[model samples]
Target chain A: MKQSITLGSVTRFIGLAGFLETIKNVFTGKLDKEDFKNIFRKVIMPLASVLLFFAVWYLSANKLHEIEADHLINKALVEQGPAEAEKLRACIASGDKSCQPNALPSPVQVWGAYQTLLADHYVISADKKAFKKKTASLNAKRIANGEKPITYTGRPSFVDQIFTSIITVFAGFLLALFIAVPIGIVIGLSHTLRSSVNWLIQIFKPVSPVVWFLLVFMIVKTFTKNSSSDSAFIICFISVGLCSMWATLVNTAMGVSSVDKDYINVAKVLKLGPMQKVFKVILPSSLPLIFTGLRITLSVAWMVLIAIELLAQSPGLGLFVWEEFQNGANDSNSKIIAAMFVIGLIGFMLDRIMLTIQKMVSFNKND
Target chain B: MSYLELKNIYKTYGEGDNTTEVLYNINLTIEEGEFVAIVGFTGSGKTTLVNLINGLLEPTKGEVLFKGEPIVGTSHERGVIFQNYSLLPWLTVGQNVYMAVKEAFPKKSKSELNTIVSEYVAMVNLSHAINKRPKELSGGMRQRVAVARALAMKPEMIIMDEPLGALDALTRVNLQDEILNIWGKEKRTALLITNDVDEGIYMADRIIPLRPGPNATLGPEFKIDIERPRDKTEMNDNPNFKKTRNAIIEYLMEIGNERKSEVQKEYILPDLAPKSFVW
Candidate 1:
């Protein structure tokens, strides 16, 4: 059989057949009027909106910069008279580095900062590689001698901090899954248990991540006081887990409890053991809702991760952002803006990942 | 000894002033190899009775005996095909049947279980859809999968609770024939609860009516004297089929009339005339 990769097949494979069809129609000069309109709405509209956003941001940044510069010139005139004010104006007009306004960074500056962060990451990676090469024989010798090898104490780059944040979020997410699912199932199985535990969930669900961080900090600090390992990561992850787990707990309980009575009847008729019934029938039936719960739990964990990291003083994006704010360098504002975009983009990607998993597991294709 | 017996079964819901008697003094007995159907109006405690038989529910005042022993809980010996086609949506048609078969014959090997599952699926003429999930199948196909799941268990008895109610007329007739063919082969002790009088007469050895509730009970039994391998087209001409169906329908109608009269009320209408408007 001759296998052909038709345009239709390729478009379908990429999940953009409709859009691709419109593009093809336009190129061939056979576009339907409606298809042309749809192209504008679907493709061009979003791109245009993004460009509009950048234009607005650039204008706002320039305005803010001008206002700050004027404020600084006025302050100099009032505090130190015309000579100093003239000197400040001269410095500002010279486009000198010292007189720059510490205001909102322009889009171009943020882009530059993003590139700078990448370059910094590459430099740090090269340094780490070199250090590894230098210490390879020494590390091997130390391992042979049953002694601890020398470890690099270099500060993490922007990319390393992002990874740290992602890892912490995942660890917290796993912690939440392990703690909440079993408890949710147990509570969901029994009306009495559900009612008894209802108040506890309600009270804790609304508790802030900061408070959770403080509580975890107190407990983890006391427990790991004598240990050599730093307890910030432990505290950070635990706080995130506690902060984010309530959604999963509530959703899982609801899912398990609200499983179709017909399915339960089937289980009864089949005389399935309690464990078998749960795993084979009840869990499978309730999986969609449980996944919805997990999706919510993961997004919540990621959202709260930064706050927990900042409070716990863990080496993640949250710490990086705080340090940038404290440093108040000329490009620090641009770096912060870059981090904000990265955070939002990463959160969106995490949600999409969860949605894909949920779709794969769920029987209800309509969702 | 009776293969199955329900003596003085009374099922009630709530308590004190809130108590509503759903089934009252419902007594029934089925001998070995007997096929009995309890036909009734909708919401006439037909399901409650089936549940009582299947050990999903307890009779308030009486005992359910299976093989001269008091029934405790659900068992593989009596498999129930529920009205709503209670197929686990996540499971494929084959897996649904295999699940029940595995539970029924725990000692059976994997291949043996697979063979039994496929055999039942093929019996339902749904071999093509064996790997399809319940949601993917049509209503008729899902119903067939339910039948396959129940029969694959190879229970000593089969209990159906209005299993063909949701199906269209053609599918209903087709399934009625399929079920009759399967039951005829093994002569398994069966109880089918349905509202369709003709369905009861066609599929069952005996037809019994359940009176409408607040307090429901089994009424008179109509014995179906139709011959084995009954032809659906010829059933219209068969005097026995006509007699049995008419008698069951008549009994059901009489009870329905009685219940209607008990709750009937007369209201006087106001003498009013519509005013004509020229537009």
Candidate 2:
């Protein structure tokens, strides 16, 4: 059975074949049919606009190069003579050795940076394998001598940095769920507890990620004072998780409280135990809103994790961006820009994943 | 002692200027295995009265008693079937029934519980859609699931809050027969709250009218002396059925007209001028 493209809908996003086929059809003049108009509007039109943006960006980047070259030319003319100025002018005209060293890199430069990072990752992975083998033999010899075997500690690669960021955000989100959901339920069930927790929620809801990161680091540092890898990881994820937990907590409480009164009455009529009432009726009815809150919480966790990782110098994508900026090399700016797009794409994917899970559990879907 | 009783029940809401009385000095009783129906207008506080009896709401002036003990809270001994929005929409019809059965009979074996759930689902003639969720079924079907869920618990008494009120007329008559058939077999004490006079007369052993509120009270009880397995078509031919229905409807109409007069009357001064018509 064939799965037809449901144009102008989610299929345009999820069906890669449909997206590619539409573009191909347009080029081949086969997309003039009325059947493909929705595909054109929903899919091809967005692509056109994106291409237009790239064109504008490419042109502006070229203009920025000329502007900088002119500045340098004037400076050289004043300091030296026309001879050196002319040489710089020629390089500028040739589109080489121009633009401010720290100017924003164009898409092409960012693409190049992405390839370079990929190559760098491969090289580091090979190095890690070799290091592991060398350490294994050394550890074997040390074990034979009955001494403590040395462990190899190495820097994470670019790919490893991305994984680190993902894991940290997820860990924080899980922690937030663990802490917030039960509390939300309690607050939802009891008027007194709700009033008591309301103030705390209001006060802490808007506390900045940096502040949370600092507070978490201080607390975790005290606990894992002599620790290394595990401590930093725990600190990073916990800080982000706690900082982002307010959304899910508030939404969960609201969801629980606002579950249809009829359902609650049914629960009461059934004489369901407190636990049974919550799990059987309240939770199922509130699942849609709770999942909505969870989705928001997850996104918040992901957004805050980068900043937390950056502040704590935890080995994640945010740290990668910071380190690249500090490196101040020829391709450093481009590498940072590349990381920005990668961060954005990952955040989008995380939301989509959460949305899928939300749809699975929810009976009354909003979308 | 009566199986269920409400003594001098006066339910009020709010305080001071906001205080509004709903039910006033309502005393009622239901004997074991007796089927009773309370008929009322839309705002007659019938639901509030049902809630009081079910122990969901407390009466300001009095209390309810079940089996000689004052009702403190909701209990599995009294199962309730609401008109709508009763079953968990996420759960299948079978699962909805299973949930209640499991709660009421915690010691039942897994297989035995499954059997009880299916039996009730089949009893409601919804065996074909047992696996379907509440949202997938029509209004009548969902109500059937509610009925099945309530009956599966095997509660000593069943409280039905207009269980057939939302269904179509035909569906209502069909369900009325089904309920009667079920009640004939088990003889559980049932309290049905409905506005439909025919429905109340057809389903219950006694029909009671709740006068319209701000302080609604049970007006009069009409004992239905018709035999079991009463046919809806044959009910038109029965002289007792016609006489009883007319009496109930006539009582309801009197109360309805009384409530209408109770509303603030608009005044219009008669204009005493005859204008000359232009020829």
Candidate 3:
């Protein structure tokens, strides 16, 4: 298949060459009919091969999909009750089946469920006074129907939870950045500091996020009696943030300290002020390394965030995944899979954000 | 009084049992606006001497006096052109020169400083590549930028530590002429450290050779009485230029031979393996 693609590319190049020649001849008042035939011969056969390669892929993709589908079907049968499982198997094998074996609740069903969830919470209720009156009437209606009274979770709304998680992550990252970069610079610049801190950094750098969680949990328990609030979220965030900060701190310090001594001499000879020396000379020279550190730190922070959420039951994508995992249902696997996809997408976006920032500050454009 | 004076300067590296002498009893003086070249074999402590004069390194004994006052640490007053063309790689040629100009005249407006930097860049005939970084420049062009940077500072004395040593022969001659032209216009006190005898004779008012070391000191001084605005081809034809070059070369060769034997003697060892106990 790859070979056919290469052949196809060669044909495309031949076609381009022929087109260029025809244009050249038209401008120069000269044309060769034989050249056109030769170009066609060179281009057409390869183009046919490329088409043939894609045809093979088109044929094979369905076969691969069937194998995957069969695997999923077998797994689903093991989990289902005998009557429903037999029905699903019969539906799948019948070939005229209207229902897709792999389909979770249809898009329409999920959308309907989402609307019901939102309406139950009175999310679009007119105002606080109106919402209170509407809630009271709804409660009465539910009681008359002999339905259970809805209890408030005492946590934020879903949207508010998202906002809280974002704000916490941003604040935690900023706090980590504030502590790490300067410490890295000091470690990088001074031999004594580097040696003294090396053992400590090495020990802490590879420690798992769970250790940070337990340690932070203890500290928070001792320091603040207020759990089941934003303080819990902050505490969880700090745990992940500190765990993620070590790599960047060490990398930054090494970067700064390892800047060429010649540059230091230039700074000294220029008689730059201490602030100017650090900001202009030292920082600019170490930017590539510093950015690299930042990139590693951000990715690690994202991974640690998930671990923190899972362990602490903090509200975020991590908690969403944990909640889905705990609530087993016919659609739970799909939800877990969907949540994993979102986590990966968010991590990718974070990396891209760091890359954009790196591009903005980098003095070397060629890099 | 000489513009710059080194009175019985002594430098030793390490201490106690491990102590090793690098430079010993070095005494020299340069008159105002005079270009003095110190020629030596490699490892004869020529760089150490330049470093001391520039106050990059302090001498173990004796004082380096600029005018009548004792020399302190590195300052803007003493500009150094290092052999490596120590222009920052990240900055363009114009920016590198502007950095020094900016430091020397912190109160100047941006446009004013830019104009000054451009003038120096033009002086080196590198105006076309003013915005090019050091990595983009040829070896010769980079060194020219280094020279312009030092000269633009308007220091009282310029200390060049083999500034053109890394360039090709043709480039070296071209940069040498450029350096001489700048020195002629400014008439700043200049000290050049080089190993090339002809270069020393061509560019300096006086050439002094540093004797080969464990403990190297200044050898005899040869004064180049040749006239200024020296054309390399024309200078080669002059009898006095030939005489001065030959004299400096002979002194360097004599010191080289002494160093050769010293190394040979130091390395020759006696075979002693406890006499292989024959019991």
Best candidate, lDDT-wise? 1
The predicted structure with the larger DockQ, 1 or 3, is 1
Which residue ranges in model 2 land beyond 4 Å of their true spot? A1-37, A95-101, A143-155, A228-231, B264-279
Q: Per lDDT, what order, best first?
A: 1, 2, 3
Residues A1-367 of candidate 3: C-alpha lDDT, one tens digit per residue: 1345464444343335564555455678664797567546655565778788656755554455366557656776778656666776666667533534333333333445445434533653334446556578788888999996554444343344445556656666776788899889878878998999799999988899899989898888776774454566867788878888887798789789887877877887778888888877888888877887888788888878877877888887677667766876545445555556556767777777787677656666754
lDDT of 3 at A316: 78
DockQ of 1: 0.73
List the RMSD of every prediction in angstroms: 4.3, 4.3, 9.9
lDDT of 3 by residue, B1-279 (tens): 778889998999999999989999999999998999999888888888988988778999999999888988788999999988878777789989998999999999999999999999999999999988887889999999999998898898899999988999999988898888888988888999998888988899999999977788999899999998788899889999988888888877877887777767866578867767778
Q: 1 or 3, which is superior by TM-score?
A: 1
2 or 3: which has the higher TM-score?
2
DockQ metric for all predictions: 0.73, 0.60, 0.43
Return the DockQ of model 3. 0.43
- Model 3, stretches more than 4 Å misplaced? A1-170, A191-199, A220-229, A352-366, B16-20, B109-111, B266-279
TM-score of 1: 0.93
Residues forming the 10-long window of minimal summed lDDT in candidate 3 chain A:
A101-110
Candidate with the larger DockQ of 2 and 3: 2
lDDT per residue for candidate 1 within A1-367, as digits (tens), equals 3759898865554455776767777788886778768889766786699899999999999999889999999999999999999999889889786778799989999999999999999999999999999999999999999999988779899999999999999999999999999899888889999999899999999999999998888888889989999888999999999899998899889989999998899899999999998999878887888889999999999999987788788989999998999999988999999999999989888887787788879997843
CAPRI-wise, candidate 3 is acceptable
